[model samples]
Target chain A: MESGNLSAGEERFRKFSVYRIVEHLALIACFTVLAMTGLPQKFYSLGISQLIITSLGGIDSVRSIHHVAAAIFTVLALQHIITAFIGVVFLQWEPSMLIAVKDIHDALHNVKYCLGMAGRPAMSGRYNYKEKFVYWFILLGGVQMIATGFILWFPVIAANYLPGQFIPVSKVIHTNDAMLIFLLTAIWHIYDSIFNPEVFPLDKSIFTGMKKTTRT
Target chain B: METVINNKSGRMGVAAYIVCTALLVCFALPGQPSFAASEQGPRKVDKLFGAEGNADEDERNQCLKCHGEKGSIKKFPDGDFISTYVDPQAFTSSVHRSLRCTACHKEFSLQHHPERSFRNKLQYRIKESHVCRDCHKEGTIKSVAVHESLFRKERAGEAVVCTNCHSAHAVTPAVGGNASTGEEKYCLRCHSRETKMDFNDKECISLRVNIAELRNSPHKNMGCSDCHFGFSQENHPQRRFRYEREYRISSAEMCRKCHFDKYSKVSESIHYNMLSTGRLDAPTCIDCHGGHAVSSLGDNRALAVMKCRKCHGEVYDTYAKSVHGKALLNANNKDVPICIDCHSSHSIKNPSSSAFHDYIPEMCGKCHSNPTLMGKYGLSTDVVKTYLSDFHGMTLGLQRKEASKGYRPDPPMAVCTDCHGTHEIAGVLGADVQVLKDKLLKRCQKCHSNATSNFPDAWLSHYKPSLRVAPLVFIAEQFYKIIMPLMVVGLLFQVLLQIWRYLANR
Candidate 1:
């Protein structure tokens, strides 16, 4: 969602728009609910998971809540795609989140600098390699989840067009990829946003739409 | 473990049990007894001196001193050997313990120890039985419920002696007393006899019970009155029953006393449902557990299947051939299910119900979903996950989801039993994949009449796709397996780099 150049900011200049902030928050809400409902089903044998299922009224209620959240999540994902499309096509916007050679060089440079092999850290553009990593991982993973989830939801209809193997394949991907997404969000995104020494408490730019510039 | 669940059965079940028990209480006919050995506990020939015991203890002790000799234990009159080695403890504990030996042994004295002779044990028992009339007048004996028939039989030259039902030496209190004592001995005295009690002409139930077999039963510690309840020498109330069904139903009611959990489940079961609605052929507790010699299903799981075989012999035969049944019966595999594993022992509902059909996946999943369990059998634990993701399971899931939302699709969805038959589920152990595919294709055609042979290929058959099976699905799975880790490593590496940069800068 960070779209401006690295140098296009003054002191605490605006970075994300309100629309982008709302989208991120909505995604967070959907993702949280999904994780809570889905992981228990995945680990159904666990006592705590069973408690959660029972407390939430049972598997049916849990699934329904998950479905509703997933629907909202799917819509939000589509909204992001369409909004980005309109921005790029109609308004001639830059595809700032796209990974490039600079990101590779920057990643390598950053690693080297951290390891004391380089004198300077790599300079990031609108979005750093880390930010881009999170964005692409979640977006692609969401697409996968959505596709599989739909196959799971309307599987009888899916059987008409898709092979029978796709049904089980969708389940495997749905279950496994969910864990991956959860891990990345927990370790990487959480670390970068809040636990990083640079942003000890949080990186509030996504919420407040402003970044405090520290130009060298 | 399976049968004895909590007594959470509905009021209907409670009602059924109570009704059956009430009927049994009404039809309380006294059965015959055979008490040559049962009444006599281990003889205390030497220890006949309990000087500190009750009133008649001293006189009985002196009598036992002579009658309770070790080697001369039995009276061998022709072929019949009646126990003469009276147990001093048995005599001391009897209802008539205070009575001297001379009270019943009339015309015998210390000076003349004249042991009389008879043609047979029956004739001896009958002749010695006249001593009871010396104390209990004929009118008083006739007033007792059992005596109405027994007295008539006596007149017609077919009566059992008083000691036939109530043993001579060890007649425990006939009225209210301790149950832990020789209460069963009182009933077994006659019940041990190979005789029959006719409820009607055709409904002759065998009055015999093998004492050793009864002792070996799980209820060895319990007395006869514990189940046959309210039956003792106190009274043999005249019982009336149209047929044996009445006895069976009432007899089945005995289980709920101690085995209330199992009884509750049975009451909720389809068997009980049938019985409640007057389907007399429906099985009850005694039908499954058996009478007197009640069994423990836990020690012998296959016996549980055999119990069902009484009525469902054909189904049991089919099940015995099934992989589960074969494993259970042949290998004695405790892990595998017998009949009660699925159908349950007591509260077995109709397996054909929609609710039951819908739960097939979950029932099978108890074992299939466990990674450790499936791993032991070399089966993929992905069975449940794959099925839930499949069209059928998904449809069922949707129906539940819809029902939660206040409606239901209720589409005729297949479950585990739908594809792989219930009791006759095909063996996964070394099963030919081709044969399974053929079977699956046939199963599919049951619902999808227009389905081609290729239709079965769509179903991955519980296995997580591998290089050998469903390679397309395997590749897709492998792709994610590889990519998910790579993505996570990349993301984490960036986080480390950023953390280091920030600390170094600071």
Candidate 2:
């Protein structure tokens, strides 16, 4: 279960640690709660939005739940970053998820393959170009959301250091970024992980920390 | 032989027919007596008319001969007495001077005077006043429940009659005379009394009204009948109210008749709403404006405040201890706001309503943003200007506009009263800076969870950004103002480009 061998007869490879799987699970839970609570506030006048708010015990309760989930999400995100840093600095592991010049080359090659100009698909490392793109987009979007979310959550404190105008600006950024992330997750991420032909039902490696592989 | 007999019969028949026609003509002639005339022999002539050779004047003179002397009295068997005397001069001066006494007293005669069966003089007068109904049938004399109840319950001696207010001999036209003064005098006859007036022998209420005060009132020229439209001396005390509340509620109805538009607006007010819900203490027209002594409200701020204080004692006390109230008391400042200034005089909605809550910042803005008004007190007018630009104030403005169009706004945004007090508003300028900060932080903590001492420092205190005040906030706001639009455009472009590329590939 703890192996990542690529031997000729090997049928499975460990893709993630148990700790990483647990973290991913926590992220999923926190993100789901945050979206459930936060999206309704943005589309407050919609009937379903109102129903959601009421089912969660009114707006104030929704807000409290949202804030709690946001805190958990922030913690999980920080933990992921810290773990990656520790793996690279102390354990001498390469950060395969980091975008590099090689990733750009692979992205172009993949596009050519998609266009039928290339006979074979580009070889990828631990993460593919598509996976790397989504990873970095979410990471950057997460940082922006965190900054704006904190400013909104603690507006009075923010106002001490920032202009009063920043409060509204933070609101705009927080809402828009949330929409972007939600759309990306719903369309790109979900399609790749579950709806794609190669991963018909789901790519369960994130949850199980193991994936079956076929030798070329 | 048969033809001759038939012709003779026809001739006889024609003659009989001619005789019948002549007899009918004689009977139909002007001088001939009719069957009805023969039966009743000209139904005993009403005393209002006289025999062939006698004039109506001669018959009235004959009655006047006995009634002309003063102190001419008719004493009944029941010891109830009535004055039969008619004042000649008064009768001559009256509008009914040309009319005979028998016009009303149709049974009057020298030979057979009708027997008086009334229990008292009042009952007789009430019965006699019915003659006015024949000519004065203006359909305005319907019996009101109160007066009817009193008539049924009270003794005949205590009953009100038309003659109590209108003299029989001196009767004048109700329309042509100085009606306001005449009606006032009529009402004052019983009402000006200092003692309690008995009604039905079961209850007594003060009949006293200040005649002097009424004469000086804004409604001095208006007749009592203007408001009490259906009331008459005969129908005094129109409705029997069970309590003061009933009386007040009915009186408000009367006021609504004339002041309908204003009254309708007030009906939606908090006071009227409370009154309708059985809070008898709520103010009505006469509560703020005196019943008979109503004058102009004018700029009498103190009196107006006092009137509101009658029910809002606690709020008044709090206000009096506040800076505005203190300034008003100590300096007699006209600039300081009173209860009416903020809440308004009438048509005041519930303070907690979203509409009213949204309007509060604007209400404060009325005086605070007035340069000419606040300038005298060394107060800056930019308070509202700055607030309007602030996030909370902008939200409140938007909410208010939406509310005016009948939308229930999202949860309340912080308004002027959110931080400062409502009735107990104090001057934040003279207060110690540290204390104000602590108070502001406490106020912030009401909505904000886990607020710290530094949280209150975020407030610009109704001031816009300047280099000295909030430089960091100013820079951050400017940065985002430019960055947000660019970020949105860039993301949108990327999305469009990706979609186009996907379509092209497909």
Model 1, B440-480: lDDT tens digits are 87888787675665567667777667899889778877888
lDDT of 1 at B132: 61
Q: What is the C-alpha RMSD of each candidate to the true structure, in Å?
A: 15.1, 15.1
Give me the iRMSD of candidate 1, please. Answer: 4.5
Docking class of 2: incorrect
lDDT of 2 by residue, B198-308 (tens): 434356667578989888898889877788777643345545566665566667667787788879889889989998898887889888777887778677777778888
Clashes of 1: 6
Interface RMSD for candidates 1 onward, in order? 4.5, 6.7
